[model samples]
Target: MLTTRHFLFFLTGLCCFTISLRAEPAQFEPEAPAAEPGLAFLLPTDQFLRQELDEPDDSDPLLPPPLEDSFSQVEPTPNPDTESLPDLKTLLRPRFDISAEWEPEADGVEMISSDLNLKLPLYPVFGPPPPFLTAGYSFTRINAPVQLDLPRDLHQFSLGVSWMRPLNERWLVRTMLSGVFATDFYNTGSMAWQFRGGMFAIYRPNEEWDLAFGALATGQEDIPVLPVIGATWRPSSSVKVNLMLPNPRISYLISESETRQQWAYVGGGMSGGNWAYNLRDGSPERLNYREWRLVVGWESMPPRTPGRFQSPGASYLIEAGYVFGRKFEREHQAADIKIDNSLLLHSGIRF
Candidate 1:
């Protein structure tokens, strides 16, 4: 068995990254927190899943972290402290995203889509590497009113586990593995599905800068495996510049009140996913979707309630972005639908 080493080596050299490239909203858009195979800018293996392990807000956050990042179609970055998290039993969060203005329909194929990601974090697990560890379960759904896909919907359910270990004081190793099961849009699903995930080594040489590189794999035919990298630099306490263009965001902390905190940033990343569809005549089929985005958003977090499991009150966001590279492909079937660029609006809340 070649294992995944050769694939990893091949991908290691593919650094021709793009923020204009889109992603497949496979299972979680992060809150990208998408480590979701991240690249997702939270953008992850679900990735580049908004690339969360936290719903980066690509399913991730640029200013503040959102709660979604489970199976968002785009990879985004959610701003996480990345330092230490207060001990908690679990965290329950959810998020949703919608894209519109798809133009030049494909043969009467309307081009608007929406997706939702519900993130469940099972905290309190012990770690052999990092000080703490946890497992994650994310549920996601994507919808589009279009042709070539039967049953009117697509679904993804995933289970994952992650370990964050620190090497010395400046290096960190974050590893994650997730298994995803998706319905064929028209049928009751079976265990036969897909898998995607990543493992990263992060260097936090100091608070002002961080660097990372890793391997991300999505067991899709068109892209079976690939590599990923990320770098974050904070010039000031409130300003962040990201070198990971695919899902990069320049963020600023606008204000901080005991009961409220606000942040904002702009970034972009890849988005897309693979889903099984049915032919118009009701036959089994599969299709792949890929796209890109430029996102600008603001997020606010209300005070945290007093408790280990208390709510962070509520966090909300308003976002606007332009999306491009909308393509529906099934190359072997010679069905390549090029979707027009569109503008999208987003609103989300974490309870």
Candidate 2:
């Protein structure tokens, strides 16, 4: 019975195949025209249809595929114009620099002292100084033997202004007027006020060089005169050296700006002067004083989108120095004056 059933199934499949073979074949027609020489496979049917709908039949040939980037290939087309642009370097350079320093020190039981100093319009106080003006005060104390230290406390205050104009590119005409008030041994030092006038010239041959010569005439019960000449050289942005003649003073300044907006400066100089006094007889008293100063200071400015003449900045400075000088009375005086070398340090801030 099972063999008969298998034979019946096979006969049914053969009959269906015979009927399919007699049916006519359905035909396929090529949708696109024949391919042309040099042409590769045509774009997919959907993409070809979309391009035809968007562009007119007379459209220009589509751009060639970007040439393989070989040395002989023509340069690629630049991108279309856009608003975004690269930053310019000229806008990134810093335009101005500012700095300051201070120092103070303590001696033994004899004394404790402090000094405050500042510089402004810091780029060499350049241009014809138009109406230069300054005001400052100083205080000092002494703790020696009462007989030798009458009026051991001292105070000095001053106000000064000057009018300066450029005589030429390298020279200037400088005239100044100033007044001072102080308490000291000299009548001028004790006076309520004193006046002074001076004229000076400044010559700068180039950005790295400077020369200054000046004579100051001071008015008081006793006249004091000062004639000075000085020069400076800046070999690099971070280093400066200076020399003064006659009194023979030398100075150097070094500065650097590191990351984190940290900045530092080191400056030092040596200077000397002479003092003279005439005794009752023909004998004369002379004193020689010399000092060496050193200052190491740091500063910081607020984080800024770097630019020129931006405002609202502050700085701090610390400095120290040593001074050694001799105060000589007449040779016949009871005692030859002696002063120990002294050290000073100070700190200050500016905005």
Compared with the true structure, all predictions reach lDDT values of 0.49, 0.35
| TM-score of model 2 (CA atoms) | 0.48
Superposition error at 50 for model 1 (Å): 3.3
Best candidate per lDDT, number? 1
Tens digit of lDDT per residue, candidate 2, span 1-351? Answer: 124553454345434433433322111100111000000011111111111111111100112211111212455555432122212221121111111111122232133232222112211233212233344444444454534322344445555654545444455455656665654423332233556666656566665665667776654332256564666555654444544333222223333343224445444443322223233342444322234544454545332211112223443444455545423232234664555565544444333
Tens digits of per-residue lDDT for model 1, 312-349: 45556667777787777763477676756766555444
In terms of lDDT, the poorest run of 10 residues in model 2 is 29-38
Model 2 alpha-carbon miss at residue 289, Å:
8.6
Which residue pairs clash in candidate 2?
103-345, 103-346, 104-344, 104-345, 104-346, 105-345
